[model samples]
Target: MLIDIFHDTVCPWCRIGKKHLFDALAQRQEQEVHIRWHPFLLDNTVPAEGYEFRSFMQNRKGIKAEEIQQIFDNAQRAGEAAGVKLDFDKIRLAVNTKLSHQLIALAPANVKNDVVEAIYQAYFEDGLNIGNFDVIVAIGTAYQMDASELKSQLNDRAVSDAVIAESTFARLNGINSVPFFVINDKVKVNGSHSVEVFLETLNRAALLDIPAKI
Candidate 1:
């Protein structure tokens, strides 16, 4: 079965959802599953240099700083429940994710999942500025992506455009949120559902794939 995951690098829920999906996959060891990652920018208008994280969240949600902290606390709890750590306090910037998305797009298929996981860890755990070219280049190189080639492509305007275009296409297709999943083009799971939910969806998709008697 093939699963297409649409997510943003900065989204904590996306990381949680990814863990749930993988946990589900782990339970179904008999099934052969393929994962394809897609980019979904939560806020494309964020400047290349990014914005102060707390202020941006407050302004974007029209909430006070305390309210923003409450929201972060909620997310942190959810992340911990899923066994994924999210240190929102350490995050300083709300960055444009186009470069990070491009790095994932260019990664080899076998290691693309690792690249995505690393990017999420970098931003959410370490609070590294994933919008920075240097950070993304380091991630790509660590994943065995050619260093010079990764740098060249990430710098290319066309590659960046392609990443944005993918996000646009997703929105045009009515995917306005991050952490959405399409399972075998048949089952659709939205938001950060539980491992049981994802495993159930996988089983449903597998059943659908079975041939009918004549």
Candidate 2:
């Protein structure tokens, strides 16, 4: 089974969703499951010039800082339960995730989970500027990716354009919200559902023995 995940690194729910999926996968790694990541930029239309994270949240969602913090806390606790340590307080900027998404898009299918985890940690725990090339360069280096090669790919328009195009395609597929999952391009599990729900879905799919339908 191949899972297509439409998500953004800065999204708390996406991070939580990833953790749950990972936990479920860890329990069932002996099964056949492959994952591919796709970009679902939460605010794709936002100008390249980034805004303050809180201001953007307040303006768009009408969420006060307290509400955001409360939400973050809930997500953080969930993450811990799933064996992922998420640090929200250190996040200083919500730069456009276009570049980060591009990097993920370019990563090979086998190493994609690690690439996605790196992006999540870079944005949440490390508080690194994921939107910046320098930060991405460092992230690639840490992941044992050749920094210059990845950097060169960033400058190339093909990868970024493909990521942006996919982001739009996901929206057109009725994905108004993300952490949208497409298993085998047939099973569509949208948004953050329970780990039990995800585990059941995967197990049922596995029982199908060939292709899965959702």
Candidate 3:
């Protein structure tokens, strides 16, 4: 089964949703699946220096820090339950994820998951700046990827263009917010719902042969 996820780098809820999804997957041993990480920019045209991640959310999203904290609390709980660590205190920048998305899309099928997990953990837990080329190249290298090749590839127009195309495609699919999960290309779930909900929906989709949800 293929679960197509449209997500972003700076989204706390998206991080939590990913944790929930992975936890659901880990509990089951028999189901085989492929993870495809697609790009969805929270802000596509932000300035090069980017903006303070938390302040940007307060100003643009109009969500108070306290409300955001409550949300983060949920994420923290969800992440801990799932064995995922989220560095809420350390996250600071809202970077352009164009190149990160590009790296993910162009990566070989075998390494795409590594790319996705790297970005997610790096940005959300390790507090690395993924928008910068150097950090991305470094992450790509950690996966045993060629750093120079990745740097050259980032400058290529096709990958950035592809990121834009996928973002547009996501909007056209009626997806406004993310961690948007498209299961078997037929079932779609938005936001971080309970594991039971995911288990039920995924099993009913007939995408996995496993008789029960773990």
Q: Which candidate is the best by TM-score?
A: 1
Query: Compared with the true structure, what per-residue lDDT tens digits does model 3 show for residues 24-141?
Result: 7776668787667778887888765677877876777689999878766877777787667887788888778777888787777888876788888888888878888788888888
Model 1: CA > 4 A from native: 210-214
Estimate, for each residue in 51-134, the C-alpha lDDT of model 1 and write its tens digit: 999999899999998999999999999999999999998899999998999999999989988999999999998999999989
**For candidate 1, what is the TM-score?**
0.96
TM-score of each: 0.96, 0.90, 0.88
Candidate 3 error regions (>4 Å):
63-67, 207-214
lDDT of 1 at 155: 87
Ranking by TM-score: 1, 2, 3
Cα lDDT tens digits for candidate 2, 1-214: 7788889988878988887777777788787777777888887666554667666766687888889878778888877876677787787666789988988877766776888888888888887778888877777777777888988998998888888899899889798887888776666787777789888878776666656433
Provide the overall lDDT of each model, using Cα atoms, as 2-decimal numbers: 0.90, 0.79, 0.79
Indicate whether candidate 2 or candidate 3 has the larger TM-score: 2
| Error in Å for residue 94 of model 3 | 1.7
Query: What 10-residue stretch in candidate 3 is worst by lDDT?
Result: 205-214
Q: List runs of model 2 lying over 4 Å from the truth.
A: 46-49, 210-214
Minimal lDDT window, size 10, model 1: 205-214
